[model samples]
Target chain A: MSREHQKYRAPDALDHTRELLGKLAREVSVSDWHLVIEVRPDDLPEVALRLRDDETLSCKYISCIIGVDYVDWMEALYLLRSQEHAIPVRLRVRLDRERPEIPSVTYIWSGANWHEREAYDFFGIRFIGHPDLRRILTREDYDTHPMKKDAWPHRVRRTEWRWEDIERPKRLPGETDRRDRS
Target chain B: MSTVESKNDAVNPGSPVNQDGPAKPSFHLEEMILNMGPQHPSTHGVLRLVLHLDGELVVSVEPVLGYLHRGFEKLAESRTYLQYMAMISRLDYLSGFFMEWGYVRSIEALMGVRAPKRAEYIRVIIGELNRIMSHHVAIGDFMLNLGAVTPFFWVFRDREDAMDLVEMVTGQRMMYNYLRVGGVRWDLPDEFEAGCRKFIKEFPAKIDEYEELISDNEIFISRTLGMGIIKPYEALDYGISGPNARASGIDWDLRREVGYSVYPEFDFDVPLGQHGDCFDRYKCRIEEMRQSVRIIEQALDSICGGPVNIKLPPMIRPPAGEAYRAVETPRGEFGVYIVSNGGLRPWRLKLRDPTFSAISMIPKLTAGNKIADLVAIVGSLDLLMGGVDR
Candidate 1:
């Protein structure tokens, strides 16, 4: 209820994971929320399997797969949770901006199927080996990933019928096509 | 054309199955593609399911979502931290309080601001009330999906009563943006206790009537029992939480496990089911409502007077860090992950909606079951499209 009230703490099993992942992973640190681990794009599948199968770090459930655009590079954050320990680990993978592709973890966690598709949909970050990797939460014809910082809002994009074309159609009294008005 | 003919010949070596002759097969099997809806009523919202069916049995179900997507994560990046609170309620309209609570709690953790004692108690009270309200809808809708219409009306009647009590304090019927970053926006109204007491007193009888009406019905049991059984391991592997996961025999409730807010002070039972079936899921929700009522009763008895909100500066700028806070909503574990950049706006905000993970398991749950069972499975899961497609 108050700031000083410390009701919950991460179990000792999770504390052991910090040390284990620190030894195996590229970089490991602990945050207020969860243990953060950084791994290369190629090692994601192997690390994901270890997180799911390892005795100490059996994070069978994946909460979310978030893709953040950091201007210089794109980062993918995989929030994994071990139901047995009630501890979560944040797996961060940095992808090159020019080729934002990483091996999909759908095989490890079937729940990651949609989350990967969502990441690909928003940031145009391709997930290699992902079956049916297509745009989700957006139309199939949408050319640009709207969540990118540099991408313009859909309303501002130029379409088949521009505002100037509509204005010109209104000015021409002889125009009878409804498509012109649209 | 040559490659297609060779492949056909390879399947039926000597038989003329593909040839236009009288030597046709005795029986034919075809996978029928059926589109359930982006407009169908049973989906609960704008959700589309592309069902691959073999006669009456479902072969696979591909859920086509995004019909209700509004790009909330993208919107959060452009708005200031406090400015995004108004939109949080819209994520899960049924349990708006939990969504608002999760978002604000994450920000509080990032900024090291703790809500006062009285505010925590108020949150527990309103949060339990909202839980009951949401479960009412879940039960009513589940029954309605099985062709019973009376329970829906009965549940809504009680829900309206609960909503009246919430509106008195929050001043909004549906979208109550009452939770601020530090604490709640307003203090409890003068008649808040009396109203909640009146509802809590009569609510148990209503629940009993609801159970007697449908819980024992032959049709309801037959439809729900032994259907969509999710094993404990499968539930955890798929990241199912709240009632759905508990019904599968997983005793992992964020309220009890994480012990956020004043949930630690209140003593209540986490009703779990033995066998993970549709009936168990239904029973879990029914029992959870009773537990919520118990929690509210205790919270009301122990609540004391104090400031509901903490004083704060005009602009809230949490230091550069990230925080993830999850709360037990009626659906499941609803969480908010905030990445602050020592600025007014969040560098990135991601919503970990429990329904999103629950819905992902649909293809596996619906496979091999009859087409009609799809509705029951989805209904028992208690998904919210607003949370799923967000």
Candidate 2:
């Protein structure tokens, strides 16, 4: 590996990032993969802008936007990478499960447009200022947010016609109803 | 749908019924909406492009995907880490090993296990060979899209030799579940080195023949020279990677940038292009194949015999932590992000497919260009819907 890469390593590489985000973010934690910072949903746009424009950070590339449903709340993780420092950081915003909404960072990084849409498609986490927040990986009329823990898998086909709606044959005097069998 | 039509009709008010009388006959040039395949041949897979056109010039292009969405991520949530291996190879069918490598590496990192030096070298060699194979298909299909049929045949014919060599070691042709968590599934076969050496020695001349046949052709040059130009900043902004990003004069390659696996020891150049145009993208892939060959030769010379796989329990339960590993797949930076909750199955596994970002830029690139140029631009991007949709 190059000397510069060896110099930064992982722990110290994002030390400055931790320091910078400490002022703007609610919490900062380092993981094996990246430096994670927790930000409020309302502060996501401003925090994302600073991470991209701040000279010390310069995280211009938005690698991905991942949504995880923890049952109680939904979390949105923004994976950001800096071309200048070759360091990656993850900024996370926690949302209410009842009404998950956060401002979109499409203005800061154009790459996040599709990823945000994908998160919305599966998790139903609405992006406030998104240009077009429609279903990306699912059909337009798909009703359920399939990636949520409580949501059913999209492959399960649901029929509109119920068994009760079907006309039953005349039962014999001693015969039992099919519904009673269950 | 109604809103979109009304908006389009309002902006482009040139219907025949609304035209002013005889003497000033205005051209009724309403915007045309064209759907180019979930079934078209040149799309390479089930990808649909909804194109808005004004007379032959493309006004906008929206890529409609998910025709092949099998819910890989949701499936991963239910299966064990090892069980998910069966599906990883199918992510990018053209280059399966790299996807396997990315997934295995992430788990290995979380588990804190390291592959031996020899196994690392083997991984590098096979990975580079897969890279060459993928580029062959890409360049071939790209040429075919541009109306050159002969090069496609030649390229695929050359790729078969590499495929046979890989099959010899992996025991399968395409979906080689050859990579495990700590290392490869099996050691190299007796003749693996000899076969690789012979192929490496012969591949450069085939590349030269390809250049002679297509690179300098006047028609090909005009069609590609300045087409689909993505500036360096625009490419970075869109998070494009691999040859597409390199063609835009970015000196970023995960092999060199992050230096994962045994790639740092290999001395090879990351080929770059001056202009970020279609021609530059083609040239970059061709040059990258040469670099792959160079890396393979060095790995073959320095590789030593050792254990291929490390011992582990029947089920692998990585520690409760998140691990993200990125590898330089032929398409671009294929990364696997795994969040482990100390269980047999992953809590969340997100595949950051490079094609996802690369294809996202298609709409911007297709604007103001002729419909014919759309094919060249999309072909040069070398997107696989399998990877994008997954």
Interface RMSD of each: 2.4, 2.3
Please list the residue runs of candidate 1 whose C-alpha ends up more than 4 Å from where it truly belongs after superposition.
A1-15, A153-182, B1-28
**Chain A vs native chain A, TM-score per candidate:** 0.76, 0.76
DockQ of candidate 2 is 0.41
Error of 2 at A77 (Å): 0.9
lDDT of 1 by residue, B305-372 (tens): 88988899868899998888888999898989888889888988989899988888999999999988
TM-score, candidate 2, is 0.90
Q: State the C-alpha lDDT per candidate.
A: 0.87, 0.88
Stretches of candidate 2 off by over 4 Å are A1-10, A13-15, A153-182, B1-22
True-structure lDDT of candidate 2: 0.88
lDDT of residue A75 for candidate 1: 94
What is the RMSD of candidate 2? 6.7
- Number of the top lDDT candidate: 2
